[model samples]
Target: MKKGTLYLIAILWAVIVILPFLWALRISLIPTYTTFVSFFPKSLSELSLVNYEYLLFKTKFPRWMINSVLVSGGATFLNVLACSMLGYVLARKRLPGSNVIFTLVLALLMVPYHILVIALYLGLSKVKLTNTLFGVILPLSANPFGVFLMRQYITMIPREYEEAALVDGCSRIGALFKIVLPQALPAVGILTVTMFMETWNNFILPLVMLTKDSMKTVTVGIADLAFQTLNTNWGVLMAGSLLGAVPTVLVFVLFNRYFLRGLTLHGGLK
Candidate 1:
């Protein structure tokens, strides 16, 4: 009875989480005139791919999609690489001000990025990066949480592995590249998915930084669609949102095992 109740609760939770996406999916497929009161569309004739067609061909959405892919992928790559190196140094090597550095990283985790928006915008504007793709990517690339997560995961790795490599006459860089990195793959995967999701879903930063529609990320583009005019196309908006979610969904689906493994590091150690 308890097991059945638990399963019921889990199913309910799953429904709660997924129902919104399903509704959006339905909205995207149905005609803009069709009301959303039923489980599916009123009739087959009421459904079409017109919203997707408009989003793809008629708007700047394709450019936004390409820009989002580039920005998210680039930021994820840079964050993972830089975090791994900084994390390895912080985890393995004792250096002056290491504690202070780690503490600052942790402190930044508590500080919301929203607080820095104006400051970031002004700084990037000064550097003439405003309205550029790199303007969005550069600020998000070196997140402190990524550094902290990588640091914690690297610390969990057995130092004896690096020690063994050093005994084989491998230099620090070589050991880091050859030994530590392979061990940190799970953490790297987690950071990749995480950064991609955050960067892809980031609306405010991009909206503020990017003035040009051609350079806007998908989130910003979709939002601009919402606010650009009074008579917004709900169907296109839903379709754009659903399509924009695809890459992040794919990333999570592909790397979910690694993401879970990264989280369970301390569980095994304890």
Candidate 2:
């Protein structure tokens, strides 16, 4: 009876989560002028791709897509690489005042990121990067959470492996690449997905930093389309949102196994 009830609850929760996407998809397919009471279209004749057509051909959405990809990809790559290397160093190296540095990193994790936005904007503006993709990427690329997460994962690795590599004439950097990193791929994959998703979905920073229509990221671009003073395109907005979600979804799905492994926090070889 308990198992049956759990299954029932799971099904309900899944439906609750998926229902919004299904509704948006339905709205995307149905003609903008028509209203239907049911969950699905009334007939095949009522379905249309006009929203997608407008979204692709008539809007600056393609540019937004490109900008989003470049910015998100750049940010994720730098973040994962820097965090992993820093994490490995912090885990393996015992430099003077390292504990104080780690404590500062932990303290940073407690502070909300939004509090830094104004200061970041002012600083980036001074460097003439206010309207650039690099501005978006630079400010966000070295967050403490990624560093903390990677450090935690690296600590789980047995030091004996690094010791063995060192005895074989491997330098600290060499062992990081050949020994520690290879073992940390699962954690890295999870961090990549996380950083990519966060950067891709980031709205406020890009909205503030980028002034030109050509430089707008997808999230900001979609908001522009949705909030137009005249002829607001609800159908196109919904379609764009659904399509915009594809890459993040694909990243998670493609790295599903690694993501799960990262979450499980598996330790080094027995």
Q: Roughly what TM-score does model 2 have, to 2 decimal places?
A: 0.89
Q: Cα deviation in Å at residue 30, candidate 2?
A: 2.6
Q: What pairs collide in candidate 1?
A: none
Give the C-alpha miss distance for residue 209 in model 2, angstroms. 1.0
Q: Give one digit per residue, the lDDT tens place, for model 2 in 14-69.
A: 99999999998988876574554477767888789999999899999999999999
Candidate 1, which segments miss by more than 4 Å at Cα? 1-6, 42-45, 163-169, 260-270
| Candidate 1 TM-score over all chains jointly | 0.88
On TM-score, the candidate that comes out on top is 2
Clashing residue pairs in candidate 2 are none
The lDDT values for all models are 0.85, 0.85
